[model samples]
Target: MAQLEYADGIWSGIDEAGVARLEIDRPEVLNALDGAASARIIDLCGAWARERGVRVVVISGRGGAFCAGADVAGMATDAAAKGGFDESDSRAIIENGSRLVGAVRALPMPVIAAIDGPAVGIGASLAVAADLLYASARSYFLLTFVRIGLMPDGAATATFAASLGRARANSMALLGEKLCATEAFEVGLINGVIEEPEGLDAVVARAAAKLCASSPEALALTKAALDAATLTQYEAAIDREIAGQTRLLQTPEFQAAIAAFSAGSR
Candidate 1:
């Protein structure tokens, strides 16, 4: 009820300017999102969609990093308890990630991602789903799933491919390269990138304010039409990810990586 109560390392609030802000607040893990956090995100987006006063939505993370991706540490625990990552609960996390991206896309108003630092895996996917993406000098987009023995989920395969095309997306998903803010801006992956650190909010605010000044009907219609034109294959990609990631999570490769990560982090 009412966009689901805040908890689970996420924060949501609407400002007087009709801007709804969603902040990922788990800085200790660099804002790694778990299943519960993603669920709350989906609920918050649904609630914002219904609020007439909400004109724009802004998503960002607290601390230096925007989001480090899925809670790999949590995944490690889940895998340990379940004897593997192939369990129903682990698969649920993958499906929830797809739903999270869908929720961001479903928002009627323009959404801006103020990426202040690293956005990896689903975190990168989430940022790319925004209508406007801004980044700080310290920020980078990385599809690190390859390193963890998984492919990009959360519609990253679609959104990144749609935004930067196959070759660039492949560079990230295939090689797990870090696309820095300057490079992202140069390649047109982001709307703007601040050369100075901590100035990302200003850029995002300006973009959100401009959208707020525009006719709500016009902005919403434009976003919908653009989605229709550009994201024609998005839904199919989500389905593909859910199926593929469910299987991949069960693989020995992923299991070994999770084990190694857990040991190394300790």
Candidate 2:
């Protein structure tokens, strides 16, 4: 079996049954993505897109939580050292994030997200970007960018709205509220909610097995057609997010919010 690991705690490899598992392995920080981690995800997904042996891909976080979000502390430190956040910094982050989301959608095989706990900010985007999303009862999805004085990125604008109607998507993004697994299921944000983490894992495994049995070309084409129908504005939304986030990052209000958030975390 082919396997690859990255220093940032991302692991990718094909299993005995031809299911490719891509794991975010930073449990200490709840798998919060730093630049390196994000880059690794983009690289791995891109590589796996062309790997014929991989029938399906399952993405999950190793810790109790799926992914907390980005590395806010790291970003704050960078901002402090640089005197303020710049457009270039914001653009690079947004672009890399966009690529990660895009890679997931572009994969020829089905992509499943096994979410165990909190999926916030871009983490929520990652979960929703998957072709199938399964979560534990303890898991929740949160669009928390507004709380931090930023807008949602990672093509969340398109993905969320595509899964959830405009009204629900607006409420979630505007409120920055935590949508629990049950609520997520009721709202059609996720495919299913299991009672436990182990159950969620089993659900994903079964789904992957089912997908693996299907015709890959048919699955890929069907996914492409679905995306074309539902996510017509995905690329435009990403461009808009990058532009808006760039402006937000350079604002005094956003700087103050980050400083306060950083202090509160400490």
Candidate 3:
């Protein structure tokens, strides 16, 4: 049964077995995330995780792509409405979305990301935050924040480092390159990859069902331990990212970059 439904975006459901699935529903826009959608997703995930029967949670996107990235249209509209990009606006956007990413990390039960296609920018961050990642062979992880002249937010600065180590994370963040599912699995960024796209659902469902068999208390404790070990690091990374972003947003370099993109100059 469909568990939760919303108008703007995002749909969630928990099966009788207590396995929950949260699907990103904005396919026409390649499931690009915006403030309103992210906020709703965060709220629902938190509430569902707290419920008694929700043993495991799976997050995926509709259509061919997992999530392209932030809604460029929304960002452009917001920036225009506010006169121009400013430090305050950038910080608010980052902080608000970071909270949602953090919420997924803090979920008591296992949170799995099922990526069937491209997962870019903050989408990459969200996938990395999951306890387990199952991706189709065609799926890729792209950190496009740099391409857009924005520093990584969603706690990815730390999450990427922890999952892929310092050098790889730095390369991805600095270069804004796309990493294929196989490459991500090799680097320990993702848990596994399925060769057949059609097999993704079964693969994720089977894995999540296995997780559901474990003691919920034990699962929660395990998640807490993992999170505790990296809490300080994530916090520090978030602070650094926010500060760097604030400075960058105020710079003429970034402003020109945004303007160029908005004008389709590059």
- Using lDDT, give the best candidate's number: 1
lDDT of 1 by residue, 91-135 (tens): 787888988988999999999999998998899999999999989
Task: Put the candidates in TM-score order, highest first.
Answer: 2, 1, 3
TM values, all candidates: 0.96, 0.96, 0.93
Clashes of each: 0, 0, 0
Which residue pairs collide in model 2, if any?
none
Cα lDDT, model 3, residue 77: 66
State the local distance difference test value for candidate 3.
0.83
Per-residue accuracy of model 3 over 40-68 as CA lDDT, tens digit each: 78888889867998999899998978888
Residue 125 lDDT (model 3)? 84
Model 2 reaches what TM-score against the true structure?
0.96
For model 3, the superposed segments whose C-alpha errors exceed 4 Å read: 1-4, 230-232
Worst 10 residues of 3 by lDDT: 257-266
lDDT of each: 0.89, 0.87, 0.83
All candidates in order of lDDT, best leading:
1, 2, 3
Tens digit of per-residue lDDT, candidate 2, span 70-90 = 888888888888888778887
